[model samples]
Target: MEIRWLEAFVVVAEELHFGRAAQRLHVAQSPLSQTIRRLEASIGADLFERNTRSVSLTPAGRALLPKAYRVIQDLALATDAARTASGAVHGTVRIGFSGAFNHLTLPVLARSIRRELPEIDLQLVSRVRTGDGVAKLRNGTLDLAFVGLPLVADDIDSRLIARTRLGAVVPIDHPLADAPSLVARQLADDDFLSMPVDGSSAMTEALLRCCIAAGFRPRITQEVTDPYIMLTLVAAGLGVTIAAEDLASIMPRGARWIPLDDAPLFMLHGIGWMADEQSSALRAVLRLSEAILPTPPD
Candidate 1:
């Protein structure tokens, strides 16, 4: 079968709607339907169960998906390899980054890459959450990601790039705003807010344990991914939250940051890439990142 056929099939599988998949592929619905029908005929089985209101993948389609994904990823990697063999570092390395990485880590890394490896192209994606970054890296959509560390996964590799302590963000008018620093337990009674604490990183579990030690379990009032949004929610008198110290510069208009006194309760920021990544551009960035990101303090 043609690669386009495979591409069309994958898109349809992902979307589960012919019109939506066609829109994603930048084609009309009729031809996309025709292609899937032709693909099904060639493979001698129905890939999708379709009706007026819904579409679902058949067992055959489900079984073929991961293998097809691998075929596409391998083909792309081979193409990138061929480009690298042409004697110059060319091709884009898609790097997924989140809040603080976009505001802080990215600038330093970008300047270094531009100055030292101008031939390499960088596609920087911002606003990615930790879980989404992990998924993207695994699916070959992102070459690498700047993510929270303490990730133990069989499909990905991570290494520490920077370290930061978690701190409190409260509205400036709040009673505790003037406090210089705080022990983790002190915030237990406060209505807290934070990113999803789903074991995607060590911070979530650590935060819970810290609060429990502080004599009360935290009542999480909100779950947010954006630093500014967390601060914004605080500024609006919604709740108090915790965030990395590196993001202090962009604290929302009415919020104040108080350093946390817990020494070992810090976020370990790191680079996560697919275990089998072989991109020349990704390698160059990883090398530069080692020098750009500071060594963890003893």
Candidate 2:
């Protein structure tokens, strides 16, 4: 069967209105109706039950609906893959990173990807907010990113490549600085610096939930969007901030990194990509992510 006929049938099956489907398909109503009739004849099945009032799919049409949709989706994916294979992958793949990434790990991953996927160029971008990865992915801008959970974007697919212990970063001279391990409750009366509460920022949500799970709302004294600035605040003794243990390696001096004992031990960090589009660069980076990720703590 001609792909156009299947396309026309799928459109009408989804819309259930000849006129509206025709408009959506940017074709005349009469031609669309004719296409559907021709398609039904070719398949030897009446795909739609249409009366003067409305239209509905027959059993055969309903069964064909899902399969037809898959055909189109798979075709699109194959076409894209062909394009990628033809050296069309020579475009910059924009990547976003959450502020919570280990300072060393992020750069190391980027360098490895550049070495492996030379045809695909990469640009490192920073995002202050989170969970907007799906929107960027859908629009064809962001190829992949490293972000913290819980990411609420169902449209984008993520793999939990690594889990790092959560820790408190505080000034070295702070009262709790000497403590080898930190508990969420120990910081109850301490001034805290956190990310915003808006759902757009995934790391913010993670931090808020961490505080709540500890039994008391944090005495949040300042809200900043920049991770570097938040770390600076901790260094300046303005407030303490929580971070992943892997980040401790690159942290500036004069700050103490204390592991959280009773609190959720680890934060999930994942490599995310557009679920619908496959990228050669992304596949390479994802492989590197899996290789570099430190094993989860016991």
Candidate 3:
């Protein structure tokens, strides 16, 4: 019936003792009991089982506890946003990005968010996979995500912000390194260095499709997930791998990245946020991102 009632019910459910729950709520035990009784009556269900030796939630109470906790948490976040001093917007905006190519957007985003939204704190996570970003975004832990394309979740708005072309990473001394570019079939005979076949990075799919179009499945020799590590393996001559072209800037050592010349393969990149996001802090970050990283033409 009231926030206080839900609070009392939740505490009592947790403590499973009238005296303890009352003490935690800073109220007399009788009032706390009455509050739970009133809530149970309003819902027409027995919320708790009590006896001389023990107390515990009934099925209804157990079911309501998590929903009640979420209601309280959502209210607290809304209150904090509404009551922030001087109204400059104070809160942490968590952003998730997968793959080394994210190096392209994250630095500029961090600087922009700090300069533009001084009261907001930036929490950046190197989410190594798209599934990681999806899970965090849906759970409300991440406010924004730099996700690779082909995301199909209904609740996420995967707004295309940039595009990275698929390219091959090979030892600089490898024969293919001297060419401006080569067809996918040229590397068909060579062992491929790639992210694990797990569906984490979009490049994994793009590279596979490119090779398939070239009439062969890539002979994967290494299945490292991190882009930097895959490139390192490439440099060591373990095998050639597929990755975004921009990621070449991240590794200063032995790899020469060359794009597929005959059939260009590209990975579309985007920023993802919960489709219903209304947080001011999140909106500000999105605005800043749009200004700095507008999706390239077409």
Candidate 4:
């Protein structure tokens, strides 16, 4: 069957309304209906159960959904591969970066890529949480991603590019800010701003694990999805927070960053991608990452 037929079918399945699906596909309803009918005839089964008021996927359509998605996704990847083989390097490369990476490293990376690989277009997507970065990367949406160390997935391959220490970010005038260095036990009783319990923020979990290793489960006063917002709250004196050293570069006003005493220094940072296939843009970015960021001493 034609790819367009499957595309039209999937759109109808998702929208469940011919007019709505047609509009979403930027086509008229009559042609969309014709396409669906043609697809059904080819498959020898009706795909949608429709009436005057509603549209629903039939059994055949339900079964075809996953395969259709896979076929479309594979076809897109193939197209990108073709573009790469042609030496065009002209398609969009969606990159996922954390807030800290965006603030400190992206400018340099973007400038270098534009200068050297002017033919390859770049799209920057900032994920407030690292899990979002991983998810986007796995789903083929992101060509490459900047993530911290301790990415435990076996399906991902990464190279460590830089290292940053963990620190406590507090209000400038907060009592703990003046200490020589912050320790997990010293701030055990302090209300903290932490990441969601769902484990979306790797750095936050690293900090929490640090606290647990010191014999306490932090009394988190608030949980935020975005680490940047968590730091903002810390700056406002709402609560204390643990963040990477690079985070200080994007500190909101009134914040103080104190190095963690004997902290379990996080893996500084890494460029990651699916282990099975590496795209040209991803490899180029990885090489550039190696050049720009220092490799930690062995």
Candidate 5:
């Protein structure tokens, strides 16, 4: 089938609604529907199940989604490679990073890449969470990513870059903020803010375990995805949070980071990429990253 057919199919699978998908593709709804029908005919299976109320992917469509993402991204990478071969730029590398704790590593890596590999065009995507970054790597969208660790994907390879102990962030005026460190039980009654349990990072899981092990289930008042926002909420006295100790460096004016000494939970960070990645520019970045990024203390 034509690439446009695959493109249309992917968009429809994502949106599930024909009208929204057509709007995204800037095409007439009728033609978009026709394209989906043509793709289904070529594949000999229905990709979507639709009715008056809603649209949903069929089993076949669900199976095709990841493959379609990889195919599209790979083709784009190939086009970039071909352009570079024709003297466009030496190569282009797309790097995804979660900015929550990489405030130091990301900037250092970017500057090093620019200075040492001047011919390579570096594209940095920021604030990408660990789960999203891993998906992008698997689908060939990101050449490299800084991810939260304990990553267990066979198709991906990663190296541990940093690890920091998990701690609590509380309002500056809170009663416990003056403590040098605290055990989990000390804050059991406090209203907590946390990352959503579903698809949460390893750090969040550890935080929950820490609280439970301390003999009280945490009263999580809010679930958040961004560390900065979590800290902001803490500063606003909405709730306290458990986050990597490194976040203390960027804690907002009204927030105070207190070390959680009990159980000594830690958050691991790593740089990850697809196992079969072959881009020379990406490999170069990997090499430079190994030399520059910090590793957990031995």
Candidate 6:
């Protein structure tokens, strides 16, 4: 029932390994294991199933995870509120953003924060994938995040900031490079370079959905994490890729972006924060965003 026990439980659940969880918590494995045992006894349920080689969460562990995250986050916010009341600490806001914001949105937002909210400490974490961003927001590790839209988390609040058509990136001399636009099926047989298929990437998920809707799964030749690198590889003739059409402005010289004729296949970008967030710093940033960020096109 103690906070430390819940912290240990959450860390162990995330790592699924006592050794790694202990290392992360800077505690001995024996103590970490004892903590989890104490937590389970208090809750009257077994939280994990462990064997010699593997550790997996039990049903009780899965059920407790999200609630534990909220408890820890709420405590942290209460502490922050108390400190802010006394002016002991100016607010610190941690913001996570994907690579898509690097070229413009992030820089502009940073400058605006520096000029308008000089007392606030702005921590910018770059290259945060959409899924990871959402997770961080829920756990209170991030105050806000720029993420792919149509986000369905009940605990998160999001607003659309931009929308852009998804398109194909190809080598300049590739057969379809000169086409004005293309249907998703046109690239079915081509070697496709894509973002990693782990559920963390919104772009990768969009690409798969688009290909499947087009009647064939894309032949993925390589999985790249960075969009710039994905385009660079495409420019080298390694393979073609599906990406936001706006990226064409920053793409390498040897690559061309071809728009997708599939109207529904587009990327929606948004800023998201926990629905129950009570941080004044977060509210300030959201207010500034409304004035500084562009509205999505209809």
lDDT of each residue in 234-296, candidate 1, tens digit only: 888888877777768888788888888775567778778988766787887888888897657
Index of the highest-lDDT prediction: 6
Q: TM-score for each prediction?
A: 0.87, 0.66, 0.74, 0.78, 0.78, 0.74
In candidate 6, stretches whose alpha carbon ends up further than 4 angstroms from where it belongs are: 1-76, 83-89
Residue 94 lDDT in candidate 3: 83
Ranking by lDDT: 6, 5, 3, 1, 4, 2
lDDT winner, 2 or 6: 6
Best by TM-score: 1
Which ranges of candidate 3 are over 4 A from the true structure?
1-73, 84-86
The residue pairs that clash in candidate 3, if any, are: none
Measured with C-alpha atoms, the lDDT of residue 128 in candidate 3 is 48
Query: How does model 1 score by TM-score?
Result: 0.87
Candidate 4 pairs with clashing backbones: 163-268
The residue-by-residue lDDT of candidate 4 on 131-169, one tens digit each, is 777776675667778776668889888777667777778
Candidate 5: which stretches are off by over 4 Å?
15-38, 44-46, 49-55, 73-92, 114-127, 212-216, 294-296
**Per-candidate count of clashing residue pairs (backbone under 3 Å):** 1, 0, 0, 1, 0, 0
What's the residue-level lDDT of 25 in candidate 6? 100
| Best-to-worst TM-score order | 1, 5, 4, 3, 6, 2
- Cα lDDT, model 4, residue 162: 66
Candidate 5 versus the native: TM-score? 0.78
lDDT score at residue 132, model 5, on the 0-100 scale? 78
What tens digits encode model 6's per-residue C-alpha lDDT throughout 186-230? 888899998888887888888888888889999998998887888
Question: Which prediction has more favorable TM-score, 2 or 5?
Answer: 5
For candidate 5, the 10 contiguous residues with the lowest summed lDDT are: 83-92
lDDT of 1 at 51: 94
lDDT per residue, candidate 2, 80-167, as tens digits? 5777788654445678876546465577777776886677677877862555565656545467766666567777787776777678
